[model samples]
Target: MTDSGIPVVFIHGLWLHASSWAPWLELFRENGYQPLAPGWPGIPDTVELARADPESIADKGIDDVTRHYAAVIDTLPRKPIIIGHSFGGMIAEKLLGENEGVAAIAIDAAQIKGVLPVPLSSLRATLPVFKNPANRHRAVSLTAEEFRYSFGNAVSPEESDELHRQWTIPAPGKPLFEAATANFSPHSPAAVHTENEERGPLLLIMGGQDHTVPEVITKSTLKQYRGSSAVTDLVEFPDRGHSLTVDSGWRAVADACLDWLRKQNL
Candidate 1:
């Protein structure tokens, strides 16, 4: 399983799995990049199956997910250029912090431990899981309405419904709980190594209309690494929402990412 070309690992966020990255894979391959999207451990192959059996990923924590992605990267002949959305974005940053990837892009990344500004919208977006203590040890599934509020607010109602049908899945709740208390936890996996000198170039992409991980949250995340020697930058799409990765305007976001990667010579 040795690969020669530059490998790109696409990480997906919650409520969606690796199959959601099919469009991204095609686009990257057309540009001569090798794209690999590994689903979170124990995730079902399809949204229907995942919705039917949510327990597979129940209780999975941030540490568990990171280690799963790290194992995949370890098998690659060259360090990859990692790109992720939402929680996947958080994982991308974690991987960069660990010096695993050559470069990384995180779109609407959830806040790491050190990022302190938690907006009301972010709180609301995660309320489905965080509001209930029992969710800490169980899997959680989003209703269509919840998905619309968290991810598809900026898209049309019809499109939102379609997107929900195509990509929504059950997600493990433990990671949400871990992230919610990251700052207080003595051994929080959500804590990032923003000051790691060996960290690779990193880009944090934000959607201005995103209720889940808004610009304020992303800015706070960027500010966390200001003193670090690693090249870190921020890019914001004003009209985009949390669904920026899979929305109709996804090409614009993807092209922006390509441009950034080109600038880095990654």
Candidate 2:
């Protein structure tokens, strides 16, 4: 924790580690904001370490994972401006749902409870997991073509390949499955936001070309979020996919976030 009261906490989604926010860290720091990105429980301190032994990430479930982040926040002096991608975004919402004083930005957040209407694109994104139950503990890498299709469709071919090489890794199958079957669960993971009316300063960034969390899905989230006192903000970046955070034009998106933050004085 810095001398500054509450800083911006960047939470990375499954597969990629906290380092995925390196570029955004630079921009956020330049704007007088602090950046903190934490790893999932038992996750290696570095990317190389995690890639070498994917089996170490096996036992984390939604409850365990959410509690770990809550513990991290407990140590902070003030509530943070939580920015998350994919599953991390969902986790951010869950964190704010139970605890107040958080401002959040969910970038192409994976589907949560009330945010229904899963698209074929979302299911297709998880197709590799359906291959085997044992893969939950393994580190899987997406092929260039698969990465391009699932996350970087809007970026150039070379950029898409580079993005895949730089980030994409095997994520736990359990979380994906948990999110897929959230509606069926008695304790739905997606219900975090819809269940909390006091969630503060929420923003939903949807990629126009995103297949995973498509426009329809985001619309559903916006509709549910509209009922809250939290100042809801929505931004749609055209020609981007799920990889909007790491794609070549990632700075544009980051700038948009900062622009919003400046308005809110975060």
**Colliding residue pairs in candidate 2:** 112-190, 113-190, 113-191, 140-170
Error of 2 at 225 (Å): 1.8
Please estimate how well model 2 matches the true structure, expressed as its whole-model Cα lDDT: 0.78
Best by lDDT: 1
Worst 10 residues of 1 by lDDT: 1-10
Clashes of each: 0, 4
Candidate 2 positional error at 23, Å: 1.2
lDDT of 1 by residue, 69-111 (tens): 9999989888999999999999999999999999999999988
Candidate 2's TM-score: 0.93
- Give the poorly placed runs of model 2, Cα more than 4 Å off: 136-139
Local accuracy of candidate 2 as per-residue lDDT tens digits, 22-76 = 9988888887777788888778877787777777776566766788888887777
lDDT accuracy of residue 47 in candidate 2? 76
